[model samples]
Target: MSNAATLAGGFPDLSKLPVARQAHWMRWFTAAAIVAVLLAIGRAFANGQIEWSYVSRFLTAPVILQGIVNTMVMAVLAMALGIFLGIVVAIMRLSPNPVLKSVALGYTWLFRGTPLILQLLLWFNIALVFPTIGIPGLWSARAVDIMTPFLSALLGLGINQGAYTSEVMRAGMLSVDAGQYEAAKAIGMGRLRALRRIILPQAMRVVIPPLGNEFIGMVKATSLASVIQYPELLHSAENIYYANSRVIELLIVAGLWYLLVVSILTPLQMLLERRFARGFSQTAR
Candidate 1:
């Protein structure tokens, strides 16, 4: 029975045996239970009191198509405005002068502190305060006429987005090496030129991921414009439901469209991230 004695006697050794594989029965049981619950949920939805036919009918309707087009248009325009303001505010925040820094800080605080919907409403009703807005005597127009639902939504969304984007941009700028800034100065380059040519270019690798996520969030946030009568996707869906009273069905259709848009943006974001991270190692990315 002694393995050493048996080995000494020219018998086969048993101490060098292979390790036994574990079955992990509990893990298998947990996974199976989760799958069973998911199946039950799917079955419930399949038999739910929803009119799928209406969803299909309005899925490609002309109004729905136009709504989606408007949604994309606003998203792009608002994001462009946001990016521009963000860069300016970020630079101001980083500037050496006290006035510029304080102004930038105040702008960020005012916008980021309030509700976006409230801002939209304020812009929409700005005529109540200003009445007729113009260059004193040169020209005059009703504030209500100039600040339509489209313009109100644009100003509110774009300005609010700038407040948040400014922080993102500042963080990206700070991530760049101080040595790089000094190097730019060593060549007699000014702060703006250094940032434009050197610092910002390097910081982009770190900035793109978060910026892409924010853009995706902007796409979803466009739905909030519906409250102001902007004819984006959710507004159009609500119009159909308001007429026929198929509330859940129309909501489901909107949800599906939102999901589709977000899904497409996710892959595109990944592509942008990869493009910016080209020089970095896999682990760094």
Candidate 2:
């Protein structure tokens, strides 16, 4: 019976209706199968192979804590460096001078075109290419000594980050209304002052979301610094596992700590996004 007829005949209309979207049953079956597979994974994880004891034991160990601190420091410092350079690059890219614009484009192209790991390795082994680093006329320091693991890693990761960040900043700045720039200029404001006081305030709303994601990514990306022998969290985990052969356990410990750090940052990112968005919303209204 047609559904319309069944509804119209208000007398004992308890009959089952035919499916409107026939493919829905297959979707339900697929979802059920996926749930079963996930359950199987959970059972495997619950098995004895994963040593939870070591995870608990070494999670708060002093060395692990130190590694966590170093990772945090690198992420913050690298992001700060990236933001500083990125702002300059973005402004240069937007400037009237063709030279500044070309230079900014070249900088972004060179860094972003290459692999990040390769950059890190190059910075670490810069001594092989340039034995000494510093001014041409002034006294110089040995490249290997001056470009320590920490410094090299920062230069590699942070500078690369700037290239990406510059694009983000440029996009955000462009998202700001052109009329706002004109309005600011109409008030006799200099270009820098206009951006600082007017355009940037609005542009930040668009910038915040992507910038937050980048910061969160940076926290984990700091693990790459380990390759340069910088003792961030993952490197410390590697050192522990190397000595005792509890590879999976130490890995789990590191994973948990990484999750914890990301958890802490997630709320802060949300808070900042909301703070920036609040003004935009009010202005829109």
Candidate 3:
């Protein structure tokens, strides 16, 4: 064989191409696969086996509006409480006191270790364990009734979410350099002041993206409260479907609404992330 032919056989061809050209081919192949799958799904939908009217009607229902409101309410409330508790736990975990650190670690481990569903159920039935919770001389009611399923759901979701959030916060804290902490201390900042003013602001930039994801997850997680009859989005959908016998249609409506909420939030999240990322850019410069 000629030297040119021998070299071609030895090198296999793509040695002449730039890395970017190779990447382009890889992306093209991925896009083609994605397009093929989408087309297949579209074909299935086009077969006319699904009832579109039910989905439309379900979407238009006032109950769905209420459910959406309820879902958002629960998600926001849970996230707020979770973030607050997370801050406390994260601080405690990072504290020098061994007792505080151990307690924080135990709390995180216990909650994160258990299933969220079980926690919700336990909260729902917590009143069962303590028939009444009140001042010794104060009036009291059945624990179960006092802590309604909704209240239980909120507490359960919020506390469990806090456990996870604490870890996220802790990770963010650890991402900050020790030099920053030392610098804050050198500037005559107290421990709490350093944490609040210097550390947290920086840590939050790292935390917000994951926090946004956690919020999105919480939206879905709120649906689990439906199991205990909390009447959030999924439960509301289930209620309507049961009455109308349009299970699949109602579910599709619920799914669409969830998608819509997530879509709206995604841009907001990206915007916040970008805003936070500005500091990193400035610091790099």
Candidate 4:
């Protein structure tokens, strides 16, 4: 059974034979089952008691439009406030000063520990605790007047988001190599100056993905503010359903809008990730 003798005898070459593809019966079956389930659900929705007409009508309603606009406005402002506070808090968390570090730790613990809805409710009802606020001699206003639903929602969402974003920022800063800090110091940069110029820029790449996700979450979290009468998308939908009693249709309209917003944000997030990840390896990106 020598190879040379077998070749001379004109036997077929085993290496050149076509390889047989294995059948993935289980995979095919699973995929088919999933499709069947999805179709069944789709059929149920189509034939359900839901009024498609109401969904279509309210989809472009003035109140619904306003609600979506408010939702976006709050999302942007809250995220901006969160980012600013997060940066400051993260820096303090890493500070040598015990006071600063403890304050930062306490802030994170307090906000992150509380349920978001509780925080919203507390902010909405803050007037009960403090009847008035402002500089005592110069300006004073009723707490209820100052802490309107919009302001309450903003403070609740932004401050809560800051606690979470601080951790994200701290993690990004920690991910930078120790040598980078040493290098900055070697070049005679102050800690804050080095952080502003060298560290933060580099850390942006690490933090952007999570930040985008957090922003998307913020958009959805605005719905929670509805309980406090903040007039976000869900609130608008609720109003419609209350007046017309078309609960499912109004909810479907609201759900569609949320989906649309998230769908748009997802691609934008990917773009931002790509932008920040420009110099990174393909796998890392």
Candidate 5:
């Protein structure tokens, strides 16, 4: 019937009220599009070449487990080194001295300008340029002996992370109120003492969230180390598939392991955010 038709109560039908039918129809169309994508994914998974049985068989293989352990270790070490470098660079960035700021800026610009894969390759093959690396007049070690896959990967990933973490650290430090710094100085704190004892503790509230994300990202980014023959999770999966030719299945296993690792880190990240954010409740009397 026409929307203008009067009801028994002498009121036009409810459809007479203005409504956006196009958006309503679009919602259903969007749902249908989602269903189509899902169906496509299902079809791909159902392909005979996927080999679900092989995926299940190798999911927890010993070598794969070892790779996972290696991945975790690399992520932790890289993130720790990155955090240290970030703090140092951030302090330099904040310093009033022009020389310190320039040095920090140069380091940041050079590292960020280089692609990560190139950095990894460079570190792995650095022995070609520098036969030995050590403090001059103290001792020296062969570059080839020191720059193993693990060490090279750590240096590349960690140094790259430092460039990013430096910005995060500087932002967090800037977030703290200027009054807090003045107050620390008023209380007989030296500049370094004030930063260490008063400012950084409070800045942690701002810093911890993104720092947690950097850690989790480092975990995922560790996959890149596979190119260096670092034997991380993805590399281990490749070794298996290379022998058996079960490429997709082994890849699936590696993906599942990565998902599991990320899933664990996600909750831990949330917990740390919450912990650092204590005392921020607006309702506090």
Candidate 6:
């Protein structure tokens, strides 16, 4: 019995490790510092000279609600279009044909190199280039005069998003093992069929997490449409603040709404990532 007690006493207690104890204290100190800074900032904002009534009025406005709806609509539509285009561009980037590869590279380079805001402006003013979009012999008319700000914003956002998403998709696709492709071909699958059925499924499992982040980014990027009077969330907030002259208050309201939406989206994204991760583990087993 005394031998057992001696052995137990000989073991070093983890709490006696000075480095580990110091590390724990360091983490606690860092967290307290962060909390202190946030509290200070919040107190300053609350006690500032700005009137709380303006913030209250802006939050309760029906226009702000409508702006939220418009923001969701644009995000959904743009993401749908972007994902579709991303698939095509990814395929092109991986194609054996030199022309297709060149075209895909050029498209990605052009879009990614330019600022999204510039792309939005260019699309909004696209009529300057062609003036008329229809065939010269058939139905020529001024295209710029007809295109609305909303349509232009949608096109610009969707196309640019597609370019970036394509590179992301290509990276995912390349991550899949070459052995899988060979196995699909051995079973008499056509090239396109193998890619679609065998490769894409696995690639998507890799791509989903980043795709979720891209969707969130697209939601924020839609705010650029407000510059052209598309009345998205930021624009709606701006309209209210312009009338009430409560710049910071209205901004805080908009920031909170954006935070809420992103918070909701983040969980859904995690759920999808988990679902996709199951397949990988099962395959590994």
> By lDDT, who's the top model here?
4
Cα RMSD for candidates in order? 4.5, 4.9, 5.2, 4.0, 5.4, 4.6
Segments in model 2 whose C-alpha atoms lie over 4 Å from true places = 1-23, 282-285
Model 4 per-residue lDDT at 165 = 97
How big is the positional error of residue 51 in model 5, measured in Å on the Cα after superposition? 1.1
Q: Considering summed lDDT, which 10 consecutive residues are worst modelled in model 3? A: 1-10
Tell how far residue 5 is off in model 4, in angstroms: 15
Expressed as tens digits, the lDDT of each residue in 25-84 for candidate 4 is 999999999999999999999999988988889999999999999999999999999999
Q: Which ten residues in a row have the lowest lDDT in candidate 5?
A: 276-285
The residue-level lDDT of candidate 2 at 154 comes to 94
Give lDDT per model, in order. Answer: 0.92, 0.91, 0.90, 0.95, 0.91, 0.88
Residue 268, candidate 4: C-alpha displacement in angstroms: 1.0
Given candidate 4, what's the lDDT at residue 205? 94
Let me know the TM-score candidate 6 reaches against the reference structure.
0.86
Query: Model 5: per-residue lDDT, tens digit, 140-225?
Result: 99999999999999999999999999999999899999999889888899988888888788888889989998898899899999
Which segments of model 1 are wrong by more than 4 Å? 1-33, 282-285
lDDT of 2 at 24: 85
Clashing pairs in 1: none
lDDT of 3 at 270: 85
Q: What global local distance difference test value does model 4 have?
A: 0.95
On lDDT, the stronger of 1 and 6 is 1
The C-alpha local distance difference test score for the whole of candidate 1 amounts to 0.92
Q: List the residue pairs that clash in candidate 6.
A: none
TM-score for each of the candidates: 0.88, 0.89, 0.85, 0.90, 0.90, 0.86
Model 4: which ten-residue window has the lowest total lDDT?
2-11
The CA-based lDDT of model 6 is what? 0.88
